[model samples]
Target: MADIDAIVDDLDAERADLEQVVAGLDATLWRAPTPAQGLTIADQIAHLNWTDELVMRAIRNPEAFADEFEGVLAPAHAVESISAGSAIVNAGTVERSKVPQSQLLTMWRRSAAELSGILRALPSGTRIPWFAPRPLSAAAMAASRVMETWAHGQDVFDALALTRPPTGRLVHVVRLGVRSRDFAYQLRGLEPPQEEFRVELRAPDGGTWNWGPADAPGKVEGSALHFALIATQRLHRDDSDLVARGEGPEEWLRIAQAYAGPVGRGRERQRPLDAV
Candidate 1:
């Protein structure tokens, strides 16, 4: 498990970065289409707000979360299937969009703060239920929340053509990305490679961060930003400068997912950074 304090700090930093991105947008920019299909900048924020609330609710009251989750899934009965669950969850996002942008921003900020507080106070070994069949530890859940914020923040930044530079805060996301290799394989119903895999990333501050065993047969090396983007499914392997070695590392790099969700059809190879 990671240091919960460090993870919470990074979460705060990521949320602050996202807030900065949306700070000055007018109504038109708020309504502008983001990279996500048919989702606007406002919709992105709404989705975040809704998800933040959902996670908080899950942590505070499992029974309430179950009811709310089932209500969100009322349109579909197969919540066990990833796609069905995703659609149901998306319905909540769409429902959230009915709120005015100003109100949504306020709700997002409040929920984020409440989320941070809950995560900060949780016992290290606590397991919280989420979209995945298995619950996650406090540290893992916090890290996933940060990854979601960063991934969705990219959509907002890309929609506005704003350039968000990589920072040391990305270490949390990179770590989650590396650790999720097996989960990614499981999500796709493929056998996880039986070999150890190594990941080496160049942090924005010129420090090198490494994960997995040093002498592993599989390896991935690249800019931390690129790894994070690929892990979030915002960039394809071909679009990144990452060097992959061994079949395990290469395939893992191609379909990495740091966030818990159904397997996604990742971006096409050679997709431009701006297009992400």
Candidate 2:
């Protein structure tokens, strides 16, 4: 069984890591453009803050969340295409960007802390409504938060030309990446491969994280950080060191998506710093 407390703790840690990076930024740096086109560092935090607030609503009042979600999916606001969905999601971020940097930071910090507390108190087997096709257990929700924080934080780090050291907390993202393999295909209107793909990643702690059967014909192997990057759409497959041993795994790498949403316009391939 997934340990809810542990997941929540990791979520807290993930938020703290990003908060530390942004907490000291001045107004100019706060408005710095991230790799995500047209979104500033402030906008990224605003997006996280808004989503955290939404998750709290989902947990505290399912009916209200459902009502709001229905409005989001209403005919006038239906997400008919990738750009349409992105416009809906970015609308709040754009408005929130007008807030002063200090106030936005305070808002995100408060919401993140409150979210951790709420997730910690969730009853066992309780499921939370989300934008996805199905509800998620509290633990799954918390882990997804960690993935978002980390993925968005990467854009912040890159904007500042900094490298974030890999950590064991990445295991949450790796697991999510593996679990969402089929969803990645499904979101694109393609059938998932029937055969399971073996995935082996070298974790930051010098340990091998393995999933799938030993004799699986499709296999992906490489650094956990790279896999997580590709899965989150933070890095393109060609920009990573991952190796796919079969057509199934190879194609999966091209379109891997760990988060729920419209297919992401993933980062463009760029030469590694060392190679440049």
Candidate 3:
């Protein structure tokens, strides 16, 4: 059985961390540009707040979400390429940018807390509507939300040259990264490698987390922070301490993406972290 309770707790913890940081920011800090081009810290929070509302809709009204999503994307689809999706996002964020920073932060906190409650209220094994190839269970949906919050929070932290300490919460992210291995390959139109790969990470609290077959020929071993960094595309694989043993695992690390959406143009290599 999925520890749905634990997933919700972790989600709340992730939200709390981000909320605390964002709440402390003044207007200048909120307006600072993140690592993502053309998006400020306010844009990140706006995006997350908007996404939380969408996730809630998916949870409570799947048909409505599907309808609204189609309408929102209809204009972009006419362009005939994936970049259209980016256009949709850019437009939405630009519109959301009108909201004041303090208001956006409040919206984020309330929406995130509401999302956690919705996830917790769902019965065991309830799958929610999502943009991923398949629907997600309540637990999976919560994990996805946590992953997004953490990754985007990293971007905000990087933009401000502030350190967001790693926590065991990232175990959720690394686990998602491992589970999405095949999805990552499929996103690039490549066949997923047939063999399983072991993934082992040293947690922030001196504990080890392992996934996949222990004796698998391929393996990814490293700090959870490194794995999460690459998986989120914030840091290139070479920039991290992750060691991938064997061709399959190496490739996985190189192209790993733990979130859904059209593939992102990852952070460029050799860029200074503070420069972001």
Candidate 4:
């Protein structure tokens, strides 16, 4: 794993970039449409901010999470109620579920700050608890933060007609994403791929990230941010700057996921960035 300091720096930089974008946005754009299905830009930010808090809750007190974990995990979208939404996403639902611009902005602002502080203050050597049937190290937990911030940032940029310059630490998130390919495949109840696949990415500071068994036969390479975006399904293969070369490259790219959990049949790709 990369040094914790480097990871924190990457996380902080992305957080700062996102804040700058939201700070200048008018109220109308707070809930503006994005490429993410029916979700507004506000919903994207709320998902990141809320999920980060939920992840932290598990890390802070693993045992407590077990008490109500199953019920909350039942639905990934369109929760039965705001109360259920809050319970599952570790957020207070009524406040976050509002449609008004002010409420959405407040939700994004406050949650972003709290999420940043949680990841930033965690001791370098700590191992955070993951959702289920998985062991998580401090590095893994931090990587999830990187992945979420980058993935959701894609939403804001897609909505704002903005572009995100690739960052070096993205290599870390990309690597995690590559390594999770089999898990993504399995999420659909398919047999895991047998042959190893190479995934190469550039780090935020211009380092390279590679993952897969040493002897893997093929490779995927490009800007780390693009690779991360593609894997998270935030950017489609054609829209992203990343490239995949191999027999199943396109298919693999289509299904990749990095976060820890039981991956559901993934959400379908949204329309072109401009269509929204």
Candidate 5:
């Protein structure tokens, strides 16, 4: 059976963590641009607000995507494009920090509460929609939320240079990401390589590190944090402690993307993160 409550709890924990970071931000720091172009720290948080709300809306009306999902790549494309467009409009009109830090935190808290209520009220095993790799279950939706929140949380942490101990939760996404490796490559409009690569991630607790194809020779082993950081594209391949034992590692690293939807190259910033 899928663990529904646990997945929901992860979202709760994620919201609390986000509140901790944003509630205490210095105004100037909040205004600082994050890795995403044209989005400052505050804008990112606001975007999160919009997204979480949309997830609730999706739950309420699962058929919203039904009519327009007929064309090639229509489903995922429509969803992602609409989402990206919403953020653009918000950026153009909404203040990055719309509510005060305290109130913003409060608003998020309430918003998440609403989402939780909506989710709990849903029938389990509901066929929620997503693009590529097929439609997902309600449980899968929860997991995706965990991945989204955790990945974006990494952005806020990187902005503040605030480090938190790694969580085993991250390993789940890395494993899922590897399983979806073909989709990631396809998003780049490329065929996935047939040769599998060994993937190893050291657990935060120093337990057995888990990873990719068991029979593959070349191994990429690193701390769970590094694996998560790179998989989420928060850290560039070469910048993290990630090391490929041989050729396969480099090949895999070149197109790693933890998030779903169409794949895009990681942006190169004006200054190297290491240098800044």
Candidate 6:
């Protein structure tokens, strides 16, 4: 079984890394546009804060979370579409963006801390309600938070033209990416391959992280950082260093998504700095 406490600790570290980046930024920098269209660096943090609060509510009171989820889905129920749900989610970020950056940061820090506390105290095997197809265990939820913080932090870093060094905590994201392979295909209305694909990634500490059988017909190999970026839709596949050795693995790499939601509009291909 996964270690819930350790995952929550990594989630805390991920939040701290992002907090350090944004905490140093002035108001002007906070308003800078990110790769996510129409969303500023402030919006990124606001979105995180908003989601963290919602997740906290889900953990603390599942019934209330269900009511809110129903309200969010009500408008889209007629058409059976998630666009309305998406808009409702986006609206939270837009509304939260009105707060002063300093205040927003304070709110985010409080929410994040409270969330970690709640998760740490949560009983083992307890499932937390989510907007997902099913409830998630405390450990999965915490790991998702880690992936999200890292992904959104990437946008903030890109907006400020800064680079963050890879950390051991990224293993959570890599694991999520691998586990979501089938979901990624299913979400796109494509049938997932039956056979598992071998995944071999070079970790930040010069260790190889392996998943699946070594003799699997399909394989994906690359830097863990690049794989995480691709999975999170932070980096375009064209710009990544990953290699896919078979058709199934290749297709999966092209549309990998480690996040829960409708399909994401991933980053566009960029010219290399040297080429530019």
Tell me the tens digit of each residue's lDDT in model 5 across 158-257.
6777886677677556765667666667666677778777877778778766656787887787777767666676666766777788875677776787
Instruction: State the local distance difference test value for candidate 3.
Output: 0.82
- Give the TM-score (vs. native) of candidate 1: 0.90
Q: Which residue ranges in model 4 land beyond 4 Å of their true spot? A: 71-87, 90-126, 132-135, 202-208, 213-215, 239-243, 260-276
TM-score per candidate, chains pooled: 0.90, 0.93, 0.90, 0.76, 0.81, 0.93
86-163: candidate 2 lDDT, tens digit per residue: 565678778877888889989998999899999999888998877665678998999999999999999999999999
Runs in model 5 with CA error above 4 Å? 68-103, 131-133, 209-212, 265-276
**How well is each residue in 1-276 modelled by candidate 1, as lDDT tens digits?**
478989889999999999987867898998899877778988888888888887887888877766756543332322244455577678989889889888888999999999999999987577776676466788888888888889989988888888999988888789888888887887777889887788889999998999889999889998999999999988878889899988778888887988767777766677756876
* Model 6 agreement with the true structure over 1-276: per-residue lDDT tens digits: 998889999999999989988998888999999998899999999999999988888888888877777744343232233444567678999999999988999999999999999999999889886655567899999999999999999999999889899999999999999998987887787888999999999999999999999999999999999999999999988788899999888899989988766788899989676863
- Shift in Å, residue 83, candidate 3: 6.8
lDDT of each: 0.83, 0.87, 0.82, 0.66, 0.67, 0.88
**Candidate with more favorable, higher lDDT: 1 or 2:** 2
lDDT by residue (151-257, candidate 3, tens digit) is: 98898889988898899889889989999999888778789999899998999999999999999999999999989989999998767888889999999998898
lDDT of 3 at 263: 77
Error of 3 at 199 (Å): 0.9
Worst 10 residues of 2 by lDDT: 74-83
The model with the greater TM-score, 1 or 6, is: 6
lDDT of 5 at 17: 80
54: Cα error in model 4, Å: 1.5
Candidate 2 vs. true structure, TM-score: 0.93
